[model samples]
Target: MNDKKITKESLVQMPHEDLAALVFNLSTIIQTQNEEIANLKELYKLRTAERYSSSSEQVGYLFQELEILDAVLAGQPEVEETIEVAAHSRKKRKRANACTAPADTPVCDVFHTEGAEDTMTGKDGIVYKRVEDKTINKMAVIPRKMVVECHHYAQYKALDVEAGKDNKKINLPAKTDALGASPSLVASVVVSKFDDHLPLYRQTEIFRREGFFLSRQKLASWVITYYEEL
Candidate 1:
């Protein structure tokens, strides 16, 4: 039989030289596979150590010395003392942002020119308001009531009263209905609900406090109508 066609049962009948050659080839293949597995495990360990390591491993003794220097400087007494410190200079602090008042903003000036007497004495001694400290503070002023517009249109009928004859009666439409709401008002309500996350029922209560009896159902209808028209 050919050597290529030999089975496990015919291995015992094979020549000693051919059997030794087959064993050597099988051993070489197993050794190559084992080396590949060991290389793969080593590469995995290196990658894991590089990626998952803690940030503290990067902090060295130099950073520790800087932190100790900062603490020692901060704990020093306010009085002058002959103490030696590391030659470390801190960066200058940045200035505050420049603030400009709006052109339309109304400015009201208040002066505290008058001084008051201090009756109580402190550890330093009695202190009175000698210098004036002027500071600017911005605040908002809410209106007592929201503006509600009312439009009135007068109607006149032309009659031939000279001949004592009456013409057909004509009625003119009102400038504003009982609802008396505007497009801007509806827009404000919709923005407050969606953008501000306010509910219609809460809006209704707010309107009630503002001296307007608004219903959530009406506001809901307005929202639906506004979207539908858009």
Candidate 2:
């Protein structure tokens, strides 16, 4: 038998007799391996079935023994059993009061007076004086509002023509590097994106709904510029 591996190229180069012998030997080896694999699979199935059958028989025997024990106990007289437990008391839980808004938070007062009058007058013609006012604090949210701020710089000319001085103008207010975006607006964008987990695209849509057209690219630019400045 040839000990060398028989590839397509080798087979083509080999003589007919050697090739025929190699083919026969390979087929015999494959048949024997397949038979061994089939035998192993059958043996595994037999062992599994035997294990399952023994476990089921043991369980059935246990159940039969329990039934016999139950019948024997039924023939005996019944006896009542009592258990003593110690008395115990549980402490009542105290409820916490609702927390009020922070003192620093801005408050908007809405007064509801009697009879549409600021002061209450009695049935008698006597006048009433204000003593104290009842106030209720509630947290409120104001929706985002977009407004345009126009800056007008006044130019002043020198009254004396002899004075060689340039015209004076008022200083402009401080603003962010991002075009058309204020410091507060940029801060809000940064908080909304990082803290509130809102995406730039969603913020753009929200701004659009609020009648302000802000592109996602523009918002991203503003956020990046603000972060870089910080």
Whole-model lDDT values for every prediction:
0.70, 0.74
Off by over 4 Å in 1: 1-123, 126-129, 136-144, 154-178, 223-230
lDDT of 1 by residue, 117-160 (tens): 43435688865544446587766565745676775645455556
Clash count, one per candidate: 0, 0
Candidate 2: which stretches are off by over 4 Å? 1-97, 114-135, 151-178
CA RMSD per model (angstroms): 15.6, 21.9
Q: Which pairs of residues have clashing backbones in candidate 1? A: none
Model 2 Cα lDDT, one tens digit per residue, 56-157: 446644578788976776665544344445675444433233367776888788777655555667899777777677787777899867777664655567
